[model samples]
Target: MGHRGFKSSQTQRGLAMVELVITLPLLLLLLFTFGEFGRMLFQYNSLMQASRDAGRFVAGQAWNATLGKVDLSATLQSQTKSVAVYGIPANPNGYPAVVPGLTTGNVSVAAVGTDHVQVSITYTFVPVIGSALPAFYGQSVPLGLALTSTVVMRAL
Candidate 1:
């Protein structure tokens, strides 16, 4: 009876090892998924804040008291795009974008309903693995996710 118990213990140890081996990959995948989700959320939050900042900046400057409306002048729109992309009114030399791959082209500023200014930012989120997955059976898989943030504030 004692001998049989020792044999079962050894088999149990082997079973545990096999179980770990089988589940390890799944566990790792789950962990990476969670980390990626957190990163995505963080990037989204940054975009939201940047849009808010740009909206605030534009709302304060876009109002034309004489015109009695929000002005979407070219200069004002350009500056708002700069603020959305670079956190500044001007895009300085050698200054990095607020978000990776973010560009002035991706930001748009417009007058909304004659009284409000709107700032919109669109960005693509690239995963840590890469922007696209390796082709499987000649079909390419894209992994980039698009995120957009828009804010409207009363022109000051």
Candidate 2:
């Protein structure tokens, strides 16, 4: 008559362990997916910033008096590529690239009109987490993502 509570059996010892084993991988997958998406967004923004800067620089040039067109020098083009890749026109060694396979050659500079300049940049985004958990899931994810940014600006 002292106590009438039901007592738990030894069979319940592994219930908590089984639940954790089943749910832990799912929880980890959700967490990593969010992180990977954030990483992709950051890389894309960096590309846009680089292209806008290059386009701005080119668009600011004055039209040539003799040529009657907004003349561009090779030096300016070279500097544009340098700035797009390394984030600085004068920096030789790249400061850790945001995209995995980005290069100076991937940046293109072109004149769209008499007063407009366009800068295009391409990058490949590979997720570090997506490829690591292939065994946990049955499906294989994409190898990488291709990202491009183009900026066109009119001369001032």
Candidate 3:
């Protein structure tokens, strides 16, 4: 017997509700964290693939059989940057970047060791939560993390 001559089950009717109220927020937070982590990984994978594609493009174009070395010309560099961002040698109008906030300036193409071509891409990942977080010290913390992907391929 419990309050008002009712059984214990009746008195504990709201117990589950109280527990759920307490734990729901934590569960939702964990779910969102996992989702954001997955999104970040997806973006990083896209960046890496773009870098590899650009590296392959440059490697194929920079190799000179007669010179026996890699020659990265200005036009080739521009096209490589375009390829990293748009997956093509030419940037078509209204084409979206491979990853959000990616641009031609973020891509760099270089000749490595005179025999290899290196394509590097730098991107700043902005979380879905916010671009910046408030710190305890009254300063704003940047949530955007810089991610760099580099691919080197032998010129041929």
**Cα-based RMSD of candidate 1:** 2.1
Which residue pairs collide, candidate 3?
A: none
Query: TM-scores of all models?
Result: 0.89, 0.79, 0.90
Assess candidate 3 and give its lDDT: 0.92
Q: What is the lDDT, from 0 to 100, of the residue 30 in candidate 1? A: 100
Task: Give the runs in model 1 whose Cα sits over 4 Å from its true position.
Answer: 1-7
65 Cα displacement, candidate 1 (Å): 0.9
Give the number of the best model, judged by lDDT: 3
Off by over 4 Å in 3: 1-7
lDDT of 1 at 154: 99
Rank ordering of all candidates by TM-score, starting from the highest: 3, 1, 2
lDDT of 2 by residue, 52-131 (tens): 87777767663465776777788877887877777776675647654566888899988777877788998877888443
The best-first sequence of candidates by lDDT reads 3, 1, 2
Q: Give me candidate 2's TM-score against the actual structure.
A: 0.79
RMSD of each: 2.1, 3.8, 2.8
Worst 10 residues of 1 by lDDT: 1-10
